[model samples]
Target: MALMQSKSKILIAGGGIAGLATALTLHRLGLKSITVLEQANSLRLTGACLTIWDNGWRALDAMGVGDTLRREHTQLQRIDTLSTTSGLTKCIDLQHHEMRLVQRKKLLVALAQALPSNTIRFGLKISAIHQRQDRSSIVTLEDGTQISPKVIIGCDGVNSTVAKWLGFGPPNLAGRSVFQGLGNFPQGHHFQPKTLEIWGNGITAAFGPCNETDVFWYLSRKSLSSDAEISYNSTILQEKARHLAEDLGNKEMVEVIKRSTPNSLSLTSMKYRYLWPFIAGKAQKGNVTVVGDAMHPMTPELGQGGALALEDSVTLGKCLAEVDLEKPAEIEAALKKYVEHRKGRAFEIGVQSSVSGILQSGSWWLPKLIRDKVVFNRLSPKMLHHTGYDCGPLQILS
Candidate 1:
């Protein structure tokens, strides 16, 4: 099925934050016709806390609604790194950078409401996409419906079928499960409320204000078994709580774990592909382009998984919008320029996420000290090249 108009039809696969934001960003650039095929009947955002840093907030400002997010979210000013035992504050004044923490559901709702109701096609699962030699691609749904699109973006996330069909498969699993939960302040005991991160000897834990009353918390541990096989049994989750209670040593961590039902806990790990476009020895197919987790998956270590996705979507849209839809080479050239601008930077962020993961999940004494003492002290907001410095997008249409 084609959109019937010559105004370059794009078949965006997945309606998550990444996909939705891509559609909206492209629409804003005057590229109107788009079809978002989401597998689920309704939107499902993994319930957890997502901290959109100043880098991400700046990009949102380019999208023209960073303030809308800021108004609804809790402004995070400080992230105190605490001791594993007794929960003593180790690093108290590490320059609280401007960050916004929001619940995943609320963020998704905002995206859904911003886009037209008809633009998103619910219950459409993409089984495969046939990429042609002429640089055009056709997407196929599990229902056998075919869509000939000028551009196809695989924003379907970590387990992306679009990527596999285009000859790229899942990246290596990093052997961890990022468990998350949301709960209100326990009755009769005032919650020690602050936007804080507690660094244990082996692992780290983070809890922050979701709104004003509720809180969101998350931790990632080396999964003994694959995440797919991890048992989500109530008793099993309680055991995990029991294990963590000693390390976290905070009232909120104990209360949230004890109070949160098993069904509410969100768990998953991070993964990524080797950088190919900017750096050699990795593979990246053109036209059948991938974004977000599909292109560059990352651990929650730095919380740039969503931020990178948003950046990729905007940059991809900007590049494609500048190309000549009638000329295949011209469009390819624009995409190539985009690949040059983003590929290296995206891969570096992936490395950064993994490094943070190692520091959080490892129990070694000297290595942990190096991360906290040597590494953390040397780390400055100015040192974040990926976040602070970003080329908005190339205007190469002319």
Candidate 2:
């Protein structure tokens, strides 16, 4: 079978946050020829929830979907941390910055709803891509169909085939792994609208409410066991997470973990690309470019993964809007400008998130001392500084 629309002006790989956001941004700019290719049969909502900060909301506002999402969850006003060893507690006020914990499915649905119908083609996997003599790229699908597009954006995520084809190195493991899931309270849990974190030896745990009835949580540990060792069973993983919380003496979190279903549970090691690729290599080749985790994959310490991807959409949208896609040279130039503007910022955030992962997941005395004594006292302010970034507006050139 052949694809009815064999060609597109703009093609985006991956229908997750990055791909959808890029498509929505272009739609907001009045571009009608954008197409998003998702490898999954339906939307991939594996990650149960996401923490969208102020910067992410700004990008959402630019795409005209911020207010719609804001109506679903309350704004988190503070972050509370507990050190298990010293039994010391710290609180950071977030009265100035906006933060919310939202269901991942809802976010994906919202982005998809805002776009034109058929803009996303599900289950179309790209097997290979090569540049044509005319500067366009020819993408070969898994079933042997080929589609040529004037512009190609790789938003396929950390294991991006597009990134590998562009000559980027593999992602590096951060010597730690994480378990994430969502817990439902049918009777309505009454927890305050604040993020709570527990810091234990080589382990960090956090949780917050997604709405009145559901809560999201995660556990990160320095020691990693192979998936086979952990049994690859959600029930077992959920039990393991509950056990870790029990060891940390968080009875509430243990209950939360027990209430979560197997479908919501996930476990994976943290991975990030070294800064050298961004410093020396090209994120944009010919009329092609990469966005979000496809370009820079960072640990979840800073909670900026989703936010940064949103920022990329707005930034890339602005760059592409300034040029005529019909001209291959113009498209290439626009992509280059987008890469120049984003590489430095993404690299800086990736490095900072790595540093934060070390501080939060370290078991040694030195890291614990610094974290409890110095870092906690000013954690929120420093976070505010990083999340305060503005990716500008989405506008097109005449």
Candidate 3:
């Protein structure tokens, strides 16, 4: 049987954080004929956890889910950074803002639940995209079904097919990878409500309580050039993580790694694609655009990947709300503004994250000395505060 023909005012690809948040924000702005297509059979609960800072909380509050998330997450009071080489620890105050550690699954659930039933369609994958002269998109699904929506927003992640079709290239490897896991303590564990990071030769480890009984942790190291074959086996990855934790000399982190099951461990190579070249080289074509990892996939050093996705969703919704969808010129102009604003912000964050990963993973004596002696002590708080931007509420553009 052939798939039935359908149309929507807005089609959002990838029902992850960015897509779901976009749908919610648009609905709040009185635009409800939105459909989100997710390739996965169901919502993905795969990731370990996320560190949502003040900016993310502001976005969530604008979407009306801030209180809901606040009740579920463990609010962090401060961030503690340790240097194994110098045996020094530095604490940066969060100023009582909303810096939270939440399970990825919970965050996804909250975003999904806020939307109306039937807002998202699962197991539908887009294979190709064609933009019309009138600033709309004709999308071809993997099963050969076609959809023509007035607007197409790609939230499909780092390897987004929509982004590829829109002329943006694939994400670049940052020459580093991470192994992450969650440790569950049913009887509860004795750990302060803070985010802890430890850096040493060639490796970095971080852990924090996600809730009363669970702690999220990750270990990152430089990939062996670009030629080394990295193993993805669960047991081997777990073993590698255990050894890295041991090298960090943090008893709490080591114990957390040991307590985690092999199944909870996962490895991912970091990759990013800067947005400036796409904007400068080619004018954004038609009404097709991307958000979140699809647009700007950055290193996790700054923990702004997810937060930025939330920011994108709200901003995109506001921009689109300002125009009359019936007028192609107005719609095009609104999208241009959105792209101009997001591209600048994403590029800055991407560069900052890349540099931070390099400095944190530096093994050289001079770089390590500067990072430990000056950067961590004098500049850490300033860097952290820079991410505290408030994404304002969605509004009608005058």
Cα RMSD (angstroms) for every candidate in the order listed? 3.6, 1.9, 2.7
Worst 10 residues of 1 by lDDT: 277-286
Ranked by lDDT, the better of candidates 1 and 2 is: 2
The residue-level lDDT of candidate 3 at 197 comes to: 89
How does model 3 fare in lDDT? 0.82
Q: Candidate 3, which ten residues in sequence have the lowest lDDT sum? A: 224-233
lDDT of 2 by residue, 257-279 (tens): 88896778888888898867676
Give per-residue CA lDDT, model 3, range 1-398, as digits (tens).
03223547788999988889888988877885789999999998776887898899888888888899888778888888888888888888777577888778888899899888888899998899987766677889998888877778889999988788878888899888888888889899999889898888878889998888889999898876432343457666777788888877778888898777555677888898876665573325678888899888999998999999999888888899889877778777877888887887888888889888888988888779888888877855666765778779765221
Off by over 4 Å in 3: 1-5, 224-232, 261-264, 278-283, 395-398
lDDT of 1 at 169: 49
Candidate 2 regions with alpha-carbon error over 4 angstroms: 1-6, 228-231, 396-398
Residue 63 local lDDT, model 2: 91
Candidate 1 lDDT for residue 58:
60
Q: Which has the higher lDDT value, candidate number 1 or candidate number 3?
A: 3
Among the numbered candidates, top lDDT falls to: 2
Order the candidate numbers by TM-score, best to worst. 2, 3, 1
> Any idea how many clashes model 2 has?
0
- Candidate 1 per-residue lDDT, tens place, 1-398, comes to 44422433777889988888778777767676777888999888656567787667766666655677777776755566665633345433324456666767777777777676577888988887676787577667898877776677788887778766656646778877666777665443343435667777666777776666666777766776645554455566555744675566677676666655455576666566655533541223556666777777778778788888778777887888888666767666766666666777787888888887787667777667766666666655554456564537433221
